[model samples]
Target: MQKLKIAIITLITLLSAKTSLAQQYMKFSWKDLNIDYSAFAYLIDSENVIVRINSTQSGVLKLAEAAGKLRVHPGYSSKARVLEIGIGEVIYSKDNKMSGSFPAFRLFQENYDPVTNKVSGRSYVAQATKIAQKGYLSSRPDVKVQVYNKLSDVQQNVNAAAYFLKEEAYYKQFAKPSSPATNNNTSTNNNSGNKPAASQAATPVTVHLVLVGDTKDASIGESVKSDLIKMRSLFQNTMSVNKNIKFNIKEISGDQLISTNVENTVKSLTVGSNDAIILYYSGHGSNPKGSNSDFPTAAMIKSSYKLENMGNLVSNRNPRLAIVIGDLCNSVPRTRTALPDQPLMRSAPAQHDPARVAQLLIKAKGKIVSTSSSYDEYSYSLGNNGAFTNSFVDALTSAINSHSNMSATWDAVLKQSYKEAYNKTRDIVNKTGTKGQNGFYRGSVAYN
Candidate 1:
């Protein structure tokens, strides 16, 4: 009888432990509930639903309804408490196209407001494995509320879903058409290459871009290449919109990444007062024992070069705007292994306003310096891309697509990018038990 009593007590303890774990996993702050749902077509048919949930308990249902993709049915218990919310069906577009889908989800509340008829808590998701299996819809209704298991699993599902949704939206909106050769030749000859005399006479503004990457390292070579490609694409798309502005890009990698070659390339560049110069470096870096500056020293295969010196080289040219970026470690020199590749989502292409692009890129005047990691921190990379570089590209793309041109300043974009990189690094550390990296930036390019 004693043994039986002990066994029952043990089972009850285990169940209690599990319930506590689930409760902890479901706790989310108000900021966590801010999800962008403008990509869907349901809110008002023609108008996009860009909803920001102000109240924790009352907004979950509104979000589901506005998304137009989730069919949620709420159930109440004897005391008028929500027992579970059933996801009845996954609704697609009218043409039966797979526009979007919802995973099995639930909202937890701590207190109920009698006057407002609202609860006070946050929405949460179940285990990633279960959510993945039942996230999409079938022809039949899968009406069930899943229970939360682990916080890590919940985060994994949320990040994965958000990444894929952004990618899908980007591809649908901005992907280039199939035929590039014919269209490129026509556009080049008629639109850009052969411009009218009056159009060419405008104060010619050229953006000089210098990209240096350490492609010799086995672990981060691919990442350097990926950053270079994304950087080129961003500048090409944004700068090409203005006929008065021209782009000049220089790439130095492999054997050409030596200090001498890098210095000579910077010195040889001819920049005008109306022009902008940007230099981006990606590779291994280190902070020496007694260095004065917090920025990392770029470790090339043959020699090391201080980023401050490089920034000075660019700033001395006296361009309208000078920006320098180093996507590497700012800690002691050490070897690193590549992490598993995460899903990469590019910014959606939008019709950019010429004035906005010019306001941030051309009209802005000053020097900006940014680094992937702060002093004593180790920067991280996933497969073929640096985390900070990817975040900067994402932020820059968003800035270009901003509703107001005046609001899209270089300082705002860089600051947001650094914050995002820090958050991403934190998430990676949480999952892999690795050291965290914090990005840093100083100076700004202000609007004229």
Candidate 2:
């Protein structure tokens, strides 16, 4: 009996150790997007290790030391075709050769009508430069034509063709890799403060800021242009003043949706573990999932359920300094639901949460997250800019004035922005005193 108990204890210990090692996060980037190289690393509960790719030339798939080898998705391709710029007129004659002053139109897939088998939609026409008075065989139409037209249109067409091809190339490059195995057994930090080793020198850290503005739901007056401008200025000031810190800044506007495109960009930025990444998002918040009566405060997904794509960008242990600041209105009453026009006045607040964003913050290895409002709060704004964004900028500027880090700046900005916005629109919130405190949500978490 004593021997059996000892054996069972040993077995349990091994199983527990294996389970703890299995859960991990893997991060990828643009280079890894095309070829699965050493773009990703694994962060186990205890130790994190770099995922080394063995080959880049021979096989389509390669395995990592931690995450097994993944096959690259087969990229898409299409036949290339020449496009004609302009054509004046086309005339068919009996002879094999035909002539015209204006050049013939070049046919492409878009211009050609498959149903009609003719270039019906195109402006230019195809004309044979060489013409014979007596026409040759009509059955064999395999003939060459010389095209001519305006120089400007030709230049434009060439550019268009190039752009289209480039877009297709970029899309194919973004295909996702095969999911890594989640085995605990297979799954996978250090700090030195004062004294440096004889061979070691502290390398100056480079902080990369990728600011994305999500204003797709912006009304005519609530423009986010000024907020973006202010954000840029803050980044510039930080980089210019701090001799030890270098910054690479990226600004994305509403033109870039918070979808796969945004995800790809984030992946590209956060791949290097040495980087300090600051991601700021300004936009309208919505829950794609329907409202819940029991827990009306549950957060909603703005779009699809396959939001893992967005989550994957920050889910891995990639960056050294990661700060995510979001300026979003979480408590906007659903349009279908009968709620007050003034979000502050809604009697029965629909229970919606920004849990997705919260979960993203937790998944990040080293992170500081600050939200404009609380999970259940209705963030307000006025004069064509969002309330939260304006406050966020104000807070950031204040923090800078105090010579504080990014987190301090956000805290100051958030407080100042809200103060300014509330002063401007006190009447709205004053009327519904009941939901006053309940309508605001702010998240401040520090993980270094």
Top TM-score prediction, candidate number: 1
Candidate 1 ranges beyond 4 A from true positions: 1-201, 345-348, 402-406, 428-435
- Inter-residue clash pairs, candidate 1: 223-384
- Give lDDT tens digits, candidate 1, residues 271-344: 88788889999888988668898999998767988888888988999998998988988877854335775554
**Clash count for each candidate, listed in order shown:** 1, 33
Please, what are the lDDT tens digits per residue for candidate 2 over residues 1-448? 1111000000000113213332222222222113321222222211111122222223221111111111111121022112222112111112312232122222122233323323322121122332222342122132222222332332332222211111122112222333696877652301233211311224545566666664344341123443454465445432233333456777665555545555667767634666566766655543333534111221223432122222235545366546665555444342111112221111111111112112222222454555554434454444334555545544444343323333433344455655655554444442225232122223343433
Error of 2 at 102 (Å): 55
